[model samples]
Target chain A: MLQTLPTEAALADAPPKPILQLVGVRKTFGSFAAVENIDLDVREGEFLTIVGPSGSGKTTLLRMLAGMDTPSEGNITLHGELINDVPPNKRPTCLVFQSLALFPHKSVGENIAFPLKVKGVDAAARKARALELMRIVRLPESYHDKNVMKCSGGERQRVALARALAYDPEVLFFDEPLSAIDYKLKKTLEKELKDLHRETGKTFIYITHSLEEAMVMSDRIGVMRAGRLVQVGTPEEIYGAPVDRFVCEFVGEVNTIRVKRGPDGLWSGVDVPGSFKVAPPQDGAALDEAFVVVRPEFMRFLGPGESADNRLEGTVYNEYSLGSRIQYQVRVEAKGGEKVMLVELSRARALPPGADPHVTLGWDAADAFTLES
Target chain B: MAITHKRRDAAIWGWTLFVLVVVYLPIACGALASFNKSRYFGFPVKQYSTDWWGKTVDSIEIGMIVKTSISVALLVTVFSVVIATFGALAFARYDWKGRRLYQKLILLPIFFPQPVLGLAMLLGFNAVGIQTSWMTAVFAHMVWIVPVVTLVIAIQVYGFDPSLEEAAFDLGCSRLQVLREVTLPLLWPGIWSGMLFAFLLSWSNFPLSLYTTGADSTIPEWLYAKMVAGYTPMVPALGTMATLGAAALLLAGGLVGMLVRRRATA
Candidate 1:
């Protein structure tokens, strides 16, 4: 009767509460559906990123989550209570807009303290909180009186983040805040955002079109396509085992071999003519038509006697130097005459300048995964 | 061959200075005549005195006319700015059915001649059987001014990032709070410029006030009346003062703008 009793630490380590939940959410304009059938349970302290290319309805979903818009159908609940019709100001959530949307006329302090000021907090308290948030965001204290319009792009981004943090909302929504930043700064901010999430222990719902950005900061990544949520999983799950060809291609450049299942349960390439060894599907389903996706990094050029689970003979079409790695364009014959396949290698493993143009591309079966459709 | 860059630059500067001189010539003439002792104005003054200034400043009728002009301008400035703030938002901020048509209609008053607009409004007032007074002059001034002010503010509204208001609302600000905190402050420069335009245009307006104010009189109307009838030195003296009043306001606005900019940078 007394067996298997849990300790206090075990109870504390229980899965996070679902702070915000959406069930069957859909948004539309006239006949066009912007977002549809969105069912998501945002954990209390998890960093969730919804990623998609432009026009994929990610921003529309963020708008509904931030309460700037309402779902045309379905329920958005907070703490298991329905809040479908609540306006943004009434909801304990804030959005860091894509443009940052800092009050240009206001100084850094005033901009950061806006949410507190809106709630009727006195000037003294607002200033203290603003300064604290600024410190959390690594803004200089001297920047308090500095007008936001006068700040550089990166500094203004910090101001926007601090302003959102001033609300101390249960969940914070970022609408591609880092999208406009240059690559180097974006990388820095991405890490800083992850650190901030750790420090605050607040749920963050971020939307961006960059899978790399999502990988850096998110505990869970939801990939969107068109108006639908295509896949939701951890970054590792999303990257290593994408659900389909679209999810796989959206993440990064990959070599996709269209194939049909032969009668013997082997996969025969329809595009790139070959019998290729393929890893079973992630969901372990039987498939007739499928694609085998192999990342460029996993692909290799086979030496004279080297072997792999899969191999294709081709002539070197072109070589592209990618700084740390070199990618070889291989011309392989298929059912449709000829096609180009990619083989990537580290700079150290690059073919010698006078090496033969003829080459063999190879990959282990485990490195390539099969996807239906 | 194209004009050389140096020659083009010199020509541009010369044209600007020439335009400035031409614009200020009438003001300089008014100032010169204001000091002339004789009633008639000449290029070179035979004698100079401040007698006209004393007479113009001391007259109760002139004082009442100044007060009426100030009242009309102030009223028009307040009403037009209030109406134009919302009008500007509607014109440039919102996207709704028929917004294009609404923008065109609001701007129609600006296209018509001021005198024609004044005559049309006078006819409207008469048909409605409303008594004409300085208050009616206020309405006529607004009929012409509101469009100009709305245009001034709408340009600012167009540059405004509407997400600032949305961010404020998401930060727990009510709709009115967003206006007070974000929209108004961001549009302050435009609103201030619009206010200056409304006040100055109303203060100097003659044709509209002439037709609208039947029993009452404004400074510009009185000045016009005195020019063709009494022809005293008071006419030019008051004209000089009116010009000076406008100049004073502009100088103050510029100074305030400089201070605000300095404070913002600091």
Candidate 2:
């Protein structure tokens, strides 16, 4: 299991100096800002994934990092050397485009050997390095002579990876490289990429819209919204302790109950027909109005003689099987009309057949986090 | 229903065949006449002889005209392709102020009436005190052909995946290296076709060449002079040679393209 650490604490207990740092980076296209005031430190030999919905400026930030686009404001440093004006070709980093961008006219071997050729490597050494990289990417050596256009999409992706690796760059940037692949292949490649990262020990900065993909492969994940990096933490921290409602909802299935603090120093749901115990707000800030965020897996049906800090009565409206787990959407009546709460449990803990409609859902206050609405 | 469908197919084939015959019958007639021994272009050949074909090769005036036309056409092809390539790259890769206006201006010569363009170029060269020579004819040919070559190359550039070039740069290639190793290789088809078009267009050009050619005669101008003077078997023989030369050039280009593609994939 991955350890969850608050972003601040993690930075404070630094293991090593960051290999890349962006201080107050901003990119603007004309009058509109694409990315605004992004400051980040990317640790050496770590897999950092930046994830966001489309148009969230994640790609723009990545373009700046890859040196394809320059930041409009502030500076980016590689190992404390300013690289804001470095062109992509001059930088010690490479980007694997989402399109794979394999040279359709060239053989796989030639495509992979292109960077080596640029460095003036001799023909024999280039061929040897190309074959080695092909093996590292798990592509068969026999396929090297095949035209890249003749290869399948997954095979082409492997070829692109091999080509990028041939540069032997200090850092590698992947711009949604597997987004075009089929689901099964994507899953396989995701694991392979994680393994490749470990084996190479290079700083990898990847950008994707898939939180699941980021969660599976990243040592640290940065979640962007609009034009801001709203949260950056380990996968456990991001999933368990998102900083805002946007981060909370973006990362996974979540249920938020709107609540307000009363003069009695207790919290009560504004619409729900009950007073609710809740965790303190993040950073120990007292809040007059707050939201209680609860993941479906943390909320369960209360059996007889069972209790929790926060409890509610609701009826299951729908159930969905998610392979090993089952999710139930329970409808609770409140003054606002109706509220739906999602409850998830292991398949083995599913409700018995023909159970009564009425059921009590409960969760410990510690499992439910509070954030200022 | 089957009968009507068959009738429709027959109609299409008939129209296609008619078009082909209309386009090719004149060339076929010229080729056949080139082999006829009769000096007069008659329906029936009085005799079959290789004299006219041999005479066409042996004639000093015809030889000079052919040499001048080939060199001028080659120059026009090279100049037009180079200029068009840069123009097409700019059009494909960048967005700048007045881009649409620039595109229209570049393509203006292609649509201009040939006689008017020829007259205007002749007058402009005279005004600039430039002597009318083979170079002037080459320059006039380029005025029309460059726009066409640029249009063809621009179309190809538009279909290109730009990320391929980006990936090259990311892989540590300099700008020149990316162009040499990636862009030029991928754009070979467009360049080849553009060169062929420029060469053929300049080779057969008549109106512009007539005004700007001055004392130097190109193949088409010489053919016109010969026709105006009198009908001869050598005229058809020269025509046949030009046609065969164009076919051979096209075949050679295709062979080279095939070989390059094979090597690329290998």
| Chain A TM per prediction | 0.93, 0.95
Worst 10 residues of 2 chain A by lDDT: A1-10
Residue-wise C-alpha lDDT for candidate 1, range A1-373, written one tens digit per residue: 2123222235358866789999999999999999989898887888899999999999999999888889999999999988888999999898999999998888999999999999999999999999999999999999999878889888999999999999889899999999899989989999899899989989999999888899888888899998899998877778888988789999988998888887677888899878878765442347788887889889888897899999999999798998899998888888758888887889998999989998888999889888887
> Per-residue alpha-carbon lDDT of model 2 for A288-347, expressed as tens digits?
888878899999999999999889999998999999999999999888589999999999
- What tens-digit string does per-residue lDDT give for candidate 2 at B1-266? 99999999999999999999999999999988998998887887778889999999999989999999999999999999999998998877778988989899999999999989999999999999999998899999999999999999998899889988988988888899999988987888899989999999999999999999889999888888889997798999998899889989989988988888777656
Tens-digit lDDT track of model 1 for B98-187 = 999999999998889888888988999999999999999999999899999999999999988899899999999889999999899889
Task: Return the lDDT, model 2, position B118.
Answer: 96
DockQ per candidate, 2 decimals: 0.82, 0.72
Query: Distance (Å) between predicted and true CA of B117, model 1?
Result: 2.0
Worst 10 residues of 2 chain B by lDDT: B257-266
For model 2, name the residue pairs that clash. Answer: none
